[model samples]
Target: MKGTMVALGGGGFSMSEDGASALDDYILAMTKRPRPRICFIPTASGDADTYSERFEAAFRDRADTSVLSLFCHEPWGYSDPAMLLEQDVIYVGGGSTANLLAIWRLHGLPEMLEKALDSGTVLAGISAGMNCWFESSSTDSYGPLAPLDDGLGLIPGSACPHYLSEPRRRESYQHWVATGALADGFAVDDYAAVVWRDGAFVEAVAEQRDRPVFWVERTADGVVEREIPVRLLGQ
Candidate 1:
């Protein structure tokens, strides 16, 4: 069976002031189980305590939540990589994409995550979390926006998050694709997310109606960006 993934451009619990969002609720609802086992992987943020704490607080009443911290190895964190397989949803946090990839590779998390996905664990994340699954992505991990081709490749092509909220993201990504620096890919504005099942895009969703998602591709003339219709959540 194919796995399910929710890749958010932004606007999840982390970005929300109250640590709640329609996007997050949508993710939880995907599990189709009361009190789904949810694990927060904060490797991207260096396993920051606040991030985990916020995650726990956000999902506390809705799901069985635990955090997997790679830096401090807290008692509540998932130490055994195999434990990830038991989660109903593995939610990754946003941070330095490059560093997240490095640490995850060192800990053999890539393999473990694949296993978790195969076991029907819903994979979800924002920003770097969203970028990791694609073959390439536009990221600020290197201090400046650049193309990162070394991604998990769970999804084909490339991706760019914070497309609308971040300055120059759209232009830079379009230039990269047009110049053959990055593969044809999707770009999502903050407050928007794309859903995939069996590695194929199922739909685009958003917490805000104004935010949008785009499919960017290199054409003979130049780069073309087609806006993907978004389903506004909580409607």
Candidate 2:
């Protein structure tokens, strides 16, 4: 049992049509460590306090978890040694990418997360959270697609989540073709997530009932799209 890595969509909690058990199972599958102290980065949690509370309540009955929401208005404690070492999971919430990256680099979290992953720490997040894992992606909901000015690069290429619900899949694919900055990328729909291990996706968790996970990658000629049903143990 190796550690887990996850990327979430915007609808993670009550917003999720998928049952809570499915998400828990995904979390369980992601980590071999029990009662892991999870870090929830709600930099993208938005200004709605109620939504944030709802977001936190989503992870119910996990007594060992610790939530740390970074405030972009605050200064970075750049000198702290165990700044991010105490947690077992890093969860970023959905918000503006520009803001998330600005605060992340200011606080020097990119290096922190990379080192954490090296030690087998789990990473998870929705929307902006998921996008940070890729080299760069569509900054806007539309096709104003561009390489992330500041991406952690935890995962190479690009990731375009909310694939089917929003019109991001085709837009992302177009960007990949036009720029050639990103060769292959994932365009995951809502209530679905893909877990990448080493370099390739070895496991997938589909919280949705019918919606599939779209794995779109670019070839020398053009972009290719394939829809795969979500399962716990996927290859």
Candidate 3:
């Protein structure tokens, strides 16, 4: 089955007291399944219990929620990694993109997640989670903001999250792409997400007010950018 993947620039049900339900709701709708099984993969934050708890509390009523804690070595009742296939959606939490990829490799989760996605699981995440699906991304994982061109390659090109919220993120991503250090690709501000359905670009959606989703590329003149109009949920 052709699967869907939604990469969030930032903001999610797990991140705020007011709770951004738009993105979370859109993610659930993408499952196209009644009472979808949603699993939270919090490896980025080193599988922090607080992050997992936030996910559970936020999604408890929306879907059958569970946490996959790789650091704790707890399987969350499933004996094998293959059980990931049973999930309808896997939501990755934000943190260090480099570290998250390392741990996932160590646990052999990359292959498993690939399989899950191929079998129709909607793979989605925020920040680092957003950055991991592409060929590369701009990240703060290694102290100073830098380019991480070694991603899972599930999607072509690069990605940048918190594009507007963080002052350095915009310039760093643009500069990296301009210098050929990072591939030209998409970048979304916090609370915005770019959605893909059946491997095709769908639309940019936002939980808060409409924010621009940028397509950045190098040109003969210089680095160029075009804003992709966003559709705010509930508008």
lDDT of each: 0.92, 0.64, 0.87
Best by lDDT: 1
Off by over 4 Å in 3: 73-79
Q: Write down the TM-score of every candidate.
A: 0.97, 0.80, 0.95
Model 2 agreement with the true structure over 114-178: per-residue lDDT tens digits = 77777777778777888888877656623364555356667766777777777655675566645
Cα displacement (angstroms), candidate 2, residue 139, comes to 2.6
What's the CA RMSD for each of the models?
Answer: 1.2, 4.1, 1.8
Q: What does candidate 1's lDDT look like per residue over 124-152, in tens digits?
A: 99999999999999999999999999999
Q: Between candidates 1 and 3, which one is better according to lDDT? A: 1
**Global CA lDDT computed for model 1:** 0.92
TM-score of 3: 0.95
